[model samples]
Target: METLATTEIEEDVDRISHLPDFIIHNILSRIGLWDWIRGGKEHHSQLLRLSVLSKKWFNLTASFPYLIFRIDHFHNVSRLNFFKYVEYATSRFCHHHNHVTAHTFKLSTTLREPAELDIVIKCVELVLNKGVRVLSIDILSVLGVQRYRLPNILSTVSMLESLAINGCYLPSSFMVNALQFKSLIRLKLQYISIDDEVIKYLNTSCPLLQDLEIRRCNGFKIVCVTGHQNLQNVTIAHNTQVERIHIEAPNLSELWLDERRTMQMNLVSCKKLRKVTYFGDLLPNSNSGFLSNFPFVDTLMLDTKCNNLKLSSHSLRTLVLLSNYDLEDIEFRTPNLASMYSRKYLFTMQPSVVSDSTHLKASMHCNPYGYIDATWFQKLRQFLDKKNGLEVLNLHIRTTCSLEKRDLEKLKAIELPPYELEHVQLQLDTQEESSAHRNFVDAVFWCCRPRSLILKSSSPLIDFEEQSDIVKFTHEKLLEQEDQSRTKIQIVPSSSCEAQIHLSDLKSLSKALPSAEQIIKFIKEEA
Candidate 1:
């Protein structure tokens, strides 16, 4: 019987080995090699053991198209050993699969010595020579260390399609008269110092470039991208030195600008622009007419302190406003607006949406440092009143003060809205557990009762005891209402699909709930 079992097992292994090359490669790709790199040596050994199955399996593993070398993964090894491991891995892979091209190669490492950078550059060159299509390199070095300069050899890689370089430097000298990237489609540069000349070079040379992202990079004051017919998406964010950006891409669809200070932005002939996310002050004289340039804009996110900004977009679908305390008024004339999200300090002027769309979902985030009285709730109610045809409301509150018993009574006395929302989400961030939590919960129910209530806390310092106290208090309050009204409240863990629990079973299962970020759903069913 043992001999027969051994033969059967061998036969089964042989059958798996005989699978087609593409099937075997597909299976290997789904093994999640990137996830296994974060595990211990035992898990890595298990993955390595797959190579011993057969000569074909060993060769297949050696020729794997995705190569990732993250130095942080080898935390147990010394710096010298880390360098040696990377060198050995790159050389071995290249030697074994010299004829086969890799699909992607990612390298992330901290550079302490100049020699380490040379090794990285050599490895990148080897991969590029092998026609790797997608490459991502992230280098972190000492504060005063010289930044990694882009090698001239990079311009020769015609097969490279997507490239991302972080914490590196791009010199204008390297880009001057450099050859074009015929196949390059996407480029992302972060934490680098690049100038306008390099940007101009890329715009003119790389005809196939579609997506470009420049974040937290200095040295260039003006980004003038003109006549890029193939450019589709552009993002230039958080650059302190950038003063003006002028783009005339006719095919551009999305543009995101998140500058710290005010900058002049000019968009011409971008009739296909669908979304614009601006996080800085608009021009002093700019008003509603500024949006006329983007006639087809579907989504707009403005995070500026510009006061009295009037946004009138007929085709706008989604709108997000994040304002400083200084912002006073914003009037929206978007009749087709579908979603609106606002985050700001309390008492700021809420945006007035004139949309008639019934699918409008509104989210409000308020962080009031002072006490919460009846006035705040009244203001919230008035804000919700302007959103016509509103379906769902999500409210996030972060406050230091809790509603006292006296204030709670005043809040409850206010008349509730006649129409209930389809869903209401309440994310509370408070300091501690207090008697006022119950009052706050009651105040929320008075404002706008919804058929479904989702509750969670966004406080990072909150412990399990505090989270449980809030959950228990909420459950008790909902149960008390269930006894008098026809509404039946069913509690379920939002992260789980298990059977819903009755009100009486909550205390027993309270300890089973996840802490801090746990979300509990309360479905109100009319009996």
Candidate 2:
């Protein structure tokens, strides 16, 4: 009995041995805030029970300021509990006032009634008082509901550096006259209705702002973004402004715009603008704006119906265009745009885009629906093939091509040179999760693993995973058929940077399959 007691006491003492403060802190920091709060009420609580294990854990978990309290569409949380939970969870930041580096409040679309919305406003008010640096709000639930003007609660957070607001309607006061945040460095505003108020605020405030995006805003009435000394990159989308924009940003290196029909811009300056996305056609009436502006850009994206683009003095080397313009008639200096690609939807009528240079690449999306004019498509392909241009051609394997492998063969056989085609595409259809479907996707992408390519998928996550597994499995089968030592194959996840590199052809993949097979096998072994 004495021996047993002595052993038990020693074990207990050993279990309570000191853990380094840093290690303890690391464990507490990893605990989710909501998990900690909810665990306090449950029988088999994970977080609350952990707090009692050590005094150090309790303090650190309680003090961690960077909290992510997401109240989105799916969760086991009640409305009242969620509201109370937020108030309690943010109390540390609201009352005690710590420097909250990042505070995210993601609301759900289930807030059907006005009372629920009011509760949200109050909650937002509390968090703003925390002086957060990053505030991101996505309120797509406010789609059809009548928009109530947001109170000046956001103006109080003066230390804010990055603000991302989407799908929320803003009142004129916050946009035009508000001088609340002076330290804002990066601002991304999308799908938010705009008026004169917001335009004035953007021009006056955010003097030190470096990155700005104004996209798909319905109520956008004005464009006042002019001479900013510190602005570097700007992406403006779907603006219905009256007309006429004069830009003179010396440090502004990149500019993108998908403006409305009435849009007009006189780039009296943007001399250092290396990257440019010209969207709509420069209107005939706006000849004054066009004649006065001169662009000395390195990279250009023609993403509109603007076929009459005239490049006078551009050192442009890379270009990405929308489907509609012809490249045959275009003039080129020392520029080589054959390194770029185009993004378009399927079954859409696309004109053959023109480029004087042949170093183009197809890093953009092919139409997912379908393409109407195969002749135009053939012309572009032949042009690329003739120049030995474009390292990759990213296509929509399913939706973009209405034909099967036989039909594609007919198209490929049409009197073209032996330019090794490096075709890249994605099977984003959910049905591709099956073995046969996965083979189809694999067949499309495996046609070539060019030196560089970026293929994106639109399939849902589960379908994407299933399709990925099938593609990988098919690659394994192909490796077995080919000589293992001669082929070099690299199976990279779609998320990796290496996923961007596509090669010459399916035959080449068979040749390179050995190396890629070895890589895949090694990765699985390490796992």
Candidate 3:
């Protein structure tokens, strides 16, 4: 037995070692640039380990065109040591990949002193001199007084394609034409302090720029994105002091804004703008004609507290409205609307014409301990009655804890109008205990008789053993009470929640609900 085990181990090693060098290189290359350096630290030690495997792997790993050097002085490192480490690593990386072009060079560090700022400038020049195309520099300071002023040689890099700067100030004294980046396509600036002159120079020079994102940035009040023919997408969010925004890009397709405060917006000739998301206050006194500028908008998401909203667009398909205030009236006139998502207290929807929409998603936050208002039944009934054309309905209701047994029974007693939806989804945010979900399922069954019922739990605890008891009890009780012969109930873990946390997908759910499967197996045996 010992001999056989040793032979198997040797054969496995031989299988991997005998593979072609190209296959091994492909496997190592698939590790990706972002994955190679994780946790804001270079994996030079790990790469050295990979070098011991073979001479071919060593050469391939060293020749990687993506050079990432990250330093965080917040972790109790001296400024001199940080500068020396960066300088040595950069020198070695540039020497090793001399023949290859720099695909991406990302340098993220925190610099406080004027001397540290000089080191960053020298490093930037070194990388740019190596034909760097994609560059991202994040220079953060603990004290907010100092800003890393970019070098003048930045504009001279004509081969640059993408530039992202965070917490680094731009050179404000440059000439209007001196800040030209002829081949740049994507620009992202975050937490940077730049005035109107810098914004104007960027708009005038980078005519080929397509995507722009400004987040939590300060210094300029008005942002004018005008006459950029190739500009397609723009996003501005979480800037409290931006009092005005102007856009005249005719070819722009998507615009996203987290409008925390009401700003004077002049959205002019964006004829191709198809998607818009505005999440903040839309006061009555704000720009009235701002939304009407986009004639071809398809998707709109508005989270506003305005009591009355009147919107007219020719080509809208998906609309999401999230308002804390109870909606008195909403006048949405879109002929091509199809999907509607809302988290508002619905009073009435007065769309100028009824849309041919088939999907309706309603989300609400519920405190399990709080008492449910009796008037909610009427409102929910009216909303359901109005959605007769809905073919699919998804309910995302979150609760703090499990419901009491008496309350669950009382909830189950509420009479709900039967819906004939083809597919119904119930997404609940619950803990390990599933009593609330069981009760919620009973209430859902009373309301909608869907062909397929999908129950998804959004919490982290998704153990089959813990969930089996609830599934078995609910299944047995449901079988006894109702003749659900045509309905198929599927208990699935929340796909969206699991995806966000990078959880592995479970394909089959049969083992989790064994009682239900056993009943079907018994019936098959009898036949």
What does candidate 3's lDDT look like per residue over 203-295, in tens digits?
Answer: 987889999898888878888988889999999988757888899898898998885887777775788889998877765654334467566
Candidate lDDT scores, in order, read: 0.71, 0.53, 0.62
RMSD of each: 9.8, 13.3, 11.8
What would you estimate as the lDDT of candidate 3?
0.62
TM-scores of the candidates in the order shown: 0.66, 0.56, 0.62
How many backbone clashes does every candidate have?
0, 47, 0
Q: Per-residue lDDT tens digits of candidate 1, residues 1-527?
A: 99999888777776767887667877777866554433335546756667555557666766777778787786566788777766766777777877778788888888988888888778877777777888898888886656676676777787888989998765344456765578899999899877778888777767888999999888889999888889999999988699888888889999998996777767857889999998777667777666775778888877776557678878887877777432235555666676665565442222332122344354443445456666777666665665555556566666777777787787667666633666766777777464565667777776775667788766432455555666677766555545546667778776563767766676545655665566778876775
Candidate 3 — worst ten consecutive residues by lDDT sum?
A: 518-527
- Runs of candidate 1 with Cα error greater than 4 angstroms are 1-12, 15-23, 35-40, 143-146, 171-173, 287-290, 324-328, 345-527
Order the candidates by lDDT, highest first.
1, 3, 2
Cα displacement (Å) at residue 20, model 2: 13
- Judging by lDDT against the true structure, name the best candidate: 1
How many steric clashes does model 2 contain? 47
| Cα-based lDDT at residue 237, candidate 2 | 79
Q: Pick the winner on lDDT between candidates 1 and 3.
A: 1
Off by over 4 Å in 3: 1-29, 32-47, 53-64, 72-82, 93-101, 113-115, 173-175, 283-290, 327-331, 344-371, 381-527
Cα-based lDDT at residue 288, candidate 1: 69
Tell me which of candidates 1 and 2 scores higher on lDDT. 1
TM-score of 1: 0.66
